[model samples]
Target: MLASMPGLRPDQEGPSLAEQMTALPVATLVVRPDNSIADANVRAETLLNMARSAIIGSDVARTIRIAEAGARFDIWHSNKAVAAYDIKVHAGRTAEMELDLMIAPIVDHDGWRVVSLHAQSQARKIGHRGSSGGARSAMGAAAILAHEIKNPLSGIRGAAQLLESSHNGQDSALTQLICNEVDRIAALIDRMQDFTTDRTLECQPGNIYPLIDRAAGIAAAGFARNVRITKRYDPSLPSANINDDALVQVMINLLKNAAEALEHVPKPRIRVETAFRHGVSVMVGDGKGSAVLPIEILVIDNGPGVPEHILDHLFNPFITAKRDGQGLGLALVDKLVRDMNGFVQYSRDREAGESCFRILLPMGMA
Candidate 1:
């Protein structure tokens, strides 16, 4: 009865699973209850460099050879409901690429089956070149304007100081206001200068655990003292190539934002997590050809989360969620990370009631 079902096979009345899965962007493959290749989408056929007719009805293990170079049919045929394995596939006679294969069991009228397989390439990585260019232009213009205003500001501050010394009562108060305003402007300019300056990254392979711990310690003792801090580090994580000082700056900026976001919430908390991520890559270009990105650092905070209105422009210059914020902290951070060939992105986690920021950096090439 199942073999005669319309959706069971191409000879039947209904559309096959291969037809439905071919519409998806990712490659997909369907296996029969006996661990045989029942069907494959167009993407999967292309990835395997084989024709659909030749692949269908064949053993799934016959087409895909895992990195271990052994028959993987038994793994999928096991009683396990789900399984995953990484493999490097020969794209052509000479080309090889890595891919992550996920196998999941499904039940249908025919019987129990496995539907799995997706081709992941490391060559296709994305970067933030466009946004980085915009940040550089804006930061440069602000630096120029800040520099032009610096000299006149000093004169005004000196005049205000002199006036305050010679005046009394309300007159002195007005002079003090002028001095205070000038000082604030000067400090703002200093922050802008830091953003504009071009400096070569002093990269060295260093474990990130200690760096994160140091940042948490500083936050716990300072503005974030009232907030509880949590650390989750993957001990198996390898050393990351980064400038210690710059990385520390990045951590502090994120911590400060997290602290401020949780200020009014009950039982405020912040979490820092580090681990090796696979199949996560950034595209450096908008075109078909883009490099694959690797490695990620995640910082999460339990707060109200980023406001929906300005969420898209969080990395833009002069964007701040706080009332008294100058809004240059994250902009500067974006610039510095971009300089090191990395990208920063943020997302609001409604389920977790927090805002998540992830930093992606390329691992050292072998």
Candidate 2:
């Protein structure tokens, strides 16, 4: 719609084509094959803080740079339109913009792209060229800090226990508080050490339906008591090559997360689905080899959605939206999934009004 205006031409009198684009909320740009901007909307002008005369016939890459995760400029090189999802792109020289980018080819024009930039609030802090080293640094710091603090924490806990047994009246409560707080800190440290552990994962081919049922039964009795859960299981699905217990941990954590998100909602529903989608693979080893991953499981919830600020880095440790949250649950899930040679990602169906977390696992061996 941004690219084509019905029955409207440049020579028309009364509020010409450019005026129509000015009224659009999204920043629209028509780009030449050489990456020069042929046209832009008023919103684009405002976003870039430039006049039409300055924006038109200029290089869009100089105005804004686009990156898709680690693969920068994948959208521009590709030939299809990626829709309904938000993308994080490095804008200007040092700024970032997360927006809904839709690229559509012109009707009759060859080698031209119509790029629409619809702004959103979430800024993906990861996936620039040099950002991973910083993340690894943070993880290393967490591991070292947890190990160093545990020694002092052990002494404090022992002293608290001694004082609590000897003290009476209100002093007893204070010592008990110290002991409880010490235990909590120790538990948090134990969780953090999981990230630093180089433990080898042992996975076997196993059916996931019974595992899902087991987790669902547990959540129904406990964390998800207030939520309504439904399952759409593909009974004929093959065995997923994952550790069954590890997969259960992933499921339980996901369910707890969904339950927490739905706490304030009047009607809370979580849908667990499994399907066998064929022919899904990514190129590996010089782009000639394809690794197939067809076993799909999706956890969908009718909650509001992931917050915009943390959506991009939801799986990154220490990035969380919940109060009193250490932000390691989803990160652990990602690590576990990757350890099993699988992939997990978070997405939202804006039109259907649901948030989806999908896991793709191999059947046996890729």
Candidate 3:
């Protein structure tokens, strides 16, 4: 509710109308009786990707375009509050943003309305913070990997060296790839040597399909050897802001989990897919504003879905459906993606009889 409106007392002890608008978490715009934007809060500026100077005094109809072709702007004609969900807001020449909107007419001011806009993906904001149990588990797992995994990596590197000398052409290249991959794993382990869990990943603009392909190849070469895998990539997907290594690990973990789930299925099939989701955005850790995350990566398997008993706690640390599982994989996957400003979710597509792990990430430059 706004303060110092026509119905409020002049000596109201709480925050002023301007202060209330400024402090609102959701993006807000106060429209004048003429349907011109009288004022917009900082959140509004962020949502529209425009400055206050550009937004204020502009005709609301000209500045904010409701992307629904048949929808009419009738809030000014009625006093009743208006609420809409899954609406696309296209401001100026900017990309269309998906948001829920609420417009309520000012109590005594005719043709005046307060508009609130919130992103559809606002609830999926997951970022690294020190106190989360997942972070603690990740730190412990990192220490263990740094100590235990390094020694085996060395032995593998040596074995690859022994094979490289006896191989030729394509075989030699395979051996070389093994050696290179081992070294990369070793470097990642070295970074995990730190137990602080406060290290930030180096993220850059990159297409995720190649990383998905790499993960699928690794999975097929080992745990998922018997499982049929397919790819359904959106050819026009934009680049995503990502740490390539982290993303590959996340995909590999999900694939491995799905493969394990299908261990006893009659005909196991896993599908890896990517697409662009319109208006999918999440609030960042900084709390300043939200980041539009249109890049979606999905790993789906026709397995007997996650067990109902542990489904609610699926992403939490040490939660597992496997009898001998350490349960660190999903937790680590969650941490890694969140560290790169992305989020992961799990769902069962009952109609398709598939277990799906979906990841949404911010867009990177082309």
Best by TM-score: 1
TM-score of 3: 0.54
Which numbered prediction scores highest in lDDT against the true structure?
A: 3
Per-candidate RMSD vs. true structure?
9.8, 7.6, 14.9
Between candidates 2 and 3, which one is better according to lDDT?
3
| Local distance difference test, candidate 1 | 0.68
Q: In model 2, state the lDDT of residue 220.
A: 98
| Models sorted by lDDT, best on top | 3, 2, 1
Model 2: CA > 4 A from native: 1-139, 168-170, 283-288
Ranking by TM-score: 1, 2, 3
**Which should have the higher TM-score, number 1 or number 3?**
1
Per-prediction TM-score to the true structure, in the order listed:
0.65, 0.64, 0.54
Off by over 4 Å in 3: 1-132, 137-196
lDDT of every model, 2 decimals: 0.68, 0.73, 0.76
